[model samples]
Target: MKKYFNWANIRLVLIVLLLAFLYAFTTKRNENRKLCNTTVEFQDGEQLFITHEMVNKLLIENKRDVSSIRKVALDLNNLENTINQHEMVEKAEVFVSIDGHLKAVVKQKTPVARIFEGSGSYYVDYKGTRMPLSAIHTARVPLVSGGVDNKNKEDLYELFRMIHDDEFLKKNIIGIQVLPSGSLIMKNRNFNYDINFGKTINMEKKFKNYKAFFQKAVQDSSIYNYRIINLKFTQQVVCTK
Candidate 1:
């Protein structure tokens, strides 16, 4: 029994030493391996505004010989931050493999609406975050103009989201304008009539009435019959001929 217990202890100590040696060997091997390749990929089938070449350029700017650099020496968090700071990038994730390969996964911002204020135009992304307009691509979102205050952007964004949710509105509505009296107006793509939306309150009921009235009016009369359609009142749709 004493000899058996001594043998068991020796076996346990040898196993631990073997594990330690393997860990040290792998650690030294990984530290010595240099970065040989880099890959950049975007998620969610989004259009490429920031290309892989651009990301490679950024890496090259930080380190001229990025490919030759040791894997352990690369600052992955700093690289991720650099990519995340880009105007078009929404998120960035960096990974370095033991095989000396660096991979960067990025998510690009998606625009939901475009605001044309004064001479400049910018985009409101899906997160309701403001993003600068891209010269390479123009998003075909709702164009809002006229007297839109920056403070009221969130309110207007809700309206835009509602419009986007409705297929009829998204297909037909071309432009939105905020009047000087704090009322809202929407322009149709097919007709010359103006949709007087009044204030941004009680919009669900207002749009319901407007849609019902539009369906009936289109079947009964010509599209040119009404110059202005008012949907501001509760449970009423007032049209001016």
Candidate 2:
């Protein structure tokens, strides 16, 4: 009886080992098979997506036999580096799917401010990251001068948000001026209305007050009646000519 019990236990162990070996062998074969399959979703910029165009340019230029375009093993860092080289691309990511499909995602920099460095001009994103202007891109954005820094750039983004969220200011905002202290001054293009929003703060209250005031002030002529709407005080709205 004891000998029979030991034999049964040994048989179970051997069976388990055999199954593990077969599983490993099958996995290796599948991995080897995957290396032969290829697929690419290249963006050629016909859709006007500039970041995709930048990435596709690098890949098409590489002489790495991407014709069959399969088995393309790309390092994520390298993919990011390639897109980062483009002035308009703020960040990028690349990954291959289980079905051997390659996908690249990019975050295009939304140029909020165009700054003059010297002879050349550069763009600043919301985070204040400065990038050079590419001739291919002519995005509508504000031009900032007087040496705006990273912190000023961030402040500008918030100020932009405050104005954009307001129903009146969103369509009317033409451009914003950034002072040395991160203060904001905006102008409307339609009638050249000046708006003084000193140091963007508590946007909810400020916007609400503007809306209420404009309800009466803009009854007839939406422009030329007020030169500037000062939103600096907490309770009073001072209009200037």
Candidate 3:
């Protein structure tokens, strides 16, 4: 028994107990500490949909006084849920740090296309979800008008993705109009004429032809010579004067 309780062994036991006590004390202090500050951040540098003041208001309204004494007493889950429920927020993560700072990171819904039907206007996200127009900031995405509704939001989103990925289309194309027969018409930013896109099918081939035709027309300085450029037929571009 005396050999087991040597000086080295005693020191090792004391160090282990000290570590446990310090850990428990730190945990207790952290749990009892008051909330020092609250900070909000966006995940993808998106500042269009929400403001800092708005996020603070949401926490205060939902958490009912974030100035609560105990850090662990705050309802962080409820706060996260409340912020996530906001129309502009795609997701939110709320947590209290060890330094007693309450932090929330929010991901805003990304607008891929803006749909303008009559007087009604809204945003369509990349996930095919319709979001309300933001009064905070305007997203310079492709505007789609005519024959648009919830049923065709997915199709519009797909088209918007294609336009966004294409460097030439993203810089030039401004608006897309859906016809009654489900055909499409695209308006350019620099041209007075319109592109008669016959159907949504064979989009890759149609866009390829359109790109080639646009290059040749621009090179010839005759792009504006035609009123309407149609890319409906296979491997052919029909121009109307």
Better model by TM-score, 1 or 2?
A: 1
The numbered model that scores best in TM-score is 3
Flag clash pairs in model 3.
Answer: none
Candidate 3 residues lying further than 4 Å off, grouped into runs, are 1-13, 60-69, 149-151
lDDT (0 to 1) per candidate: 0.82, 0.61, 0.84
Question: Clash pairs of candidate 2?
Answer: 38-70
The backbone clash count of each candidate, in order, is 0, 1, 0
Q: TM-score of each candidate? A: 0.85, 0.67, 0.86
Angstrom error of the Cα, residue 78, model 2: value is 4.5
Residues 1-241, model 3: lDDT tens digits: 3545489988999999999999999989888898777888988776778898899887666455566747867788898999988988899999888888888899998877898867789888767777899887998888888887666656667888888888998888899999888889998889888899887878888888989999999999899798999988967999997
Q: Who is ahead in TM-score, 1 or 3?
A: 3
Candidate 1 global lDDT = 0.82
Judge candidate 1 at residue 230 and give its lDDT: 91
Query: Lowest-lDDT window of 10 residues in candidate 3?
Result: 60-69
lDDT of 2 at 86: 68
- Cand. 1 TM to true fold: 0.85
Top candidate (lDDT) = 3
